[model samples]
Target: MGEHSKALEYYEKSIKIKEISLPLAHPDLATFCSCIGGVYSKMGEYSKALEYYEKSLKIREKSRPSTPPDLATLYNNVGQLYGKMEEYSKALPFLEEALGIFGKSLPSTHINIKIVMNAIDRVKEKL
Candidate 1:
């Protein structure tokens, strides 16, 4: 918790500085937003985390190629957050989207596929 708060404070400060110099839709801003979202998620602030995650996702989708790992990672993060919030119905779609992207982007034997598969399964069980 202590580490998350510290990280959150730093990320917020850096993001503020970045916002002035960078365009509103810059990919770097997305990265910082995602980082802040991770910190919030760690601190159990799910809604706040989702807000940042969605912000990051919007920018990333617009700026980057759709097949990249980071986009898939963002999907996974949102999915996991939904799962944590016990929104299993909402969680399934995001997790499945992550799994699809991971499948297309990562090697067949990659560990990420297995991890996401397990997350999807867990969400399904809860549903």
Candidate 2:
């Protein structure tokens, strides 16, 4: 818990600095947000995790021409977070979207696509 708090503190500082120096929709900013979101998720702060993940997704959606792999990752993260929150209905669409994007952008045998597939299956079982 102490280690996670320390990491979160550093991540927040880094995000603040990047926000000042980088464009609003910068890919690096999105990545930083996602990293912070992951930390929050590990710390069991699901709302904070979802907030940062949504911020990351907003940036990616505005800056990228098409659905990038990172956007897919954000979807997967948000979906999993909702699952952790036991919001199975909320989790389904995001997981399905992530699975669809991963299917199109990644190779058939890629681990990411498989992971999304497994998540979708798990969510379905919960539903």
Return the top candidate by TM-score: 2
Candidate 2, run of 10 with poorest lDDT: 61-70
lDDT for each residue of candidate 1 in 1-127, tens digit (9 for 90 to 100): 8888889889999999999999988999999999999989988999999999999999998888657878888999999999999999999998899889999989978998888899999999998
lDDT of 1: 0.92
Q: Write the per-residue lDDT of candidate 2 for residues 1-127, one digit (tens) a residue.
A: 9998999899889989998999999999999899989999999999999999999999988889887778898999999999999999999999989988888898989999989889999999999
Model 2: residue 81 alpha-carbon error in angstroms: 0.5
Please list the Cα RMSD from the true structure of every candidate, rounded to 1 decimal place: 1.0, 0.9
Q: Supply candidate 2's per-residue lDDT for 54.
A: 92
Q: What is the lDDT of every predicted structure here?
A: 0.92, 0.92
- In candidate 1, the residue pairs with backbone N, CA or C atoms under 3 Å apart (3 or more residues apart, or in different chains) clash, namely none
The collision pairs in model 2 are: none
